[model samples]
Target: MPYYENAIKKMLPKTYLRQHVAHEIYVALTHFQSLVPMMDKYVYNDGTMKNLMSLTGTIPVMFEDNTYNIPVCLWIEESYPQTAPICYVRPTCEMTVLSGKYISSNGEVMLPYLEEWKNGECDLVSLLQVMVVVFGDFPPVYMHSHPEPEQAPCWLQFHRQAEVLSRTDGSLYLHLASEDDLPFQQENETSC
Candidate 1:
């Protein structure tokens, strides 16, 4: 708790316009312990870079019959509450981003809640809840299919043998020619 308080407090100086920013962040962190506060450089599509406070972690998304932790990064600008925060689905190496109505190919997330964010009405906690619900309906990522393990090629040699079945004792026997003892010839098969 102390760590969170210190981190959130240090995120913005006291002179920052929003005085409730730290408290809102603290409450959000309290509810969502999976998220951790950090300061990182955010690069815009226009190549503009700015140091911003972001929460990087996974949000629980219920998909199918199981729950998946979808990695995400939420960047809160200094004018937060007044402006909507930028959110992105940060998929892991084992996951691939799924582009849809709510998520872009680059993993950017767009939700009605975010688009209609109201300073007094909206907060981080509810934003996460909305994300969870939206993501559950339309998953933002899918697990990458790992290649199957290499298997040793099985070489089976088929020989043309004559089988004799005796009706007297119901006995079966096979007879093969001497030429059948030679190794099998490799087939010239080609794949495009």
Candidate 2:
């Protein structure tokens, strides 16, 4: 049997066949538009009954006033519902290619909700919402105007290895790059 047919068949209790599981799957995919309000999820059903779909949506960027259009493909396995749908983020011009805690350079997203995906309770629309947030939080580093690696300023270089927090609450800037004192040196000691 094809993947979609198997997804609907194996997902439900063996005894409950007929139009129950298939009907639900059909309805969910067809009515996804109404579920997710923020992003527009366009689903394309492949011919036959593979249960495979290609979804595309525009997600707002968190870094600045910009948006990125991402292409997500859903592959339904035989153990779907019990197992979450395999989602992949495709490459796009609007998005800068980078990997982090939430996403990979290859466009793979690691969503906590997906791990806790509950059948009937959770749908693709909900998953898409989480996807949008994750994508937004981790914006493309390239989008920022960062100095070149070799010619980067001292503070910028330090920012990469360690945390360089910037705040504007009547802040006082401090730097300890002093040559007057050697680190862990005797108070009376002097350099010749």
Candidate 3:
């Protein structure tokens, strides 16, 4: 009937004394929070007693042939550091497979970056960057079938993924020249 969440994060093995040994879970969660501050924090039956991985927003992948706004999930276990948090790529029905054996239909990703994670020595950010980069190297294929051709967004929307944009806080949109062919420029406003 009520809800409570753990203040810290850790992807460690299931054990009895996990609560007593909280490490970079807090740091990792907070760090991810800082990067995706606007994204909603998801809790999977999360409670102070039973902490689960938190999910944020979609990591939009604009491949040359297709587009994928891959939703990401982060979870800390009882055996963290020695075992890195598993990264799940939640794909939508719109996505179609292209290539990559590590990826699965259940959204499970067997990435080498996570496989080679060294606790205390590695950070989640670096792992995330690696995942994104690897995704670029072996991206999944998406169907080009548009349900509503007239209602589709501009072509630029399907090609707006960048390292710079990924680091910036808040939501961003791809604004291209419309029929009027006006130059893309921000107004005098100080905020996005």
Tell how far residue 169 is off in model 1, in angstroms. 87
Off by over 4 Å in 2: 1-63, 93-96, 140-192
> For model 1, how big is the CA root-mean-square deviation?
16.8
Residues 74-175 of candidate 1: C-alpha lDDT, one tens digit per residue:
998888879888999998766889999999999999999999999999999999999999999999999857633452212322334433434446654333
For this target, which candidate reaches the highest lDDT against the unseen true structure? Answer: 1
TM-score, every prediction: 0.72, 0.44, 0.48
Q: Tell me the whole-model lDDT of each prediction, alpha carbons only.
A: 0.79, 0.51, 0.52
Which is the winner by TM-score between candidate 1 and candidate 3? 1
Q: lDDT value for candidate 1?
A: 0.79
Tens digits of per-residue lDDT for model 3, 1-192: 011113331333355224432433344444444323111233443533444444445555556666556666666554655677656665455555544676776566778777778766776666766766677767744555765554435564455432222215665545444333453455621232
Quick one: ranking by lDDT, best first? 1, 3, 2
Stretches off by above 4 angstroms in model 1 are: 1-3, 148-192
* Candidates ranked by TM-score: 1, 3, 2
lDDT of 2 by residue, 55-106 (tens): 4434434445666555555554445556676666654433355778766676
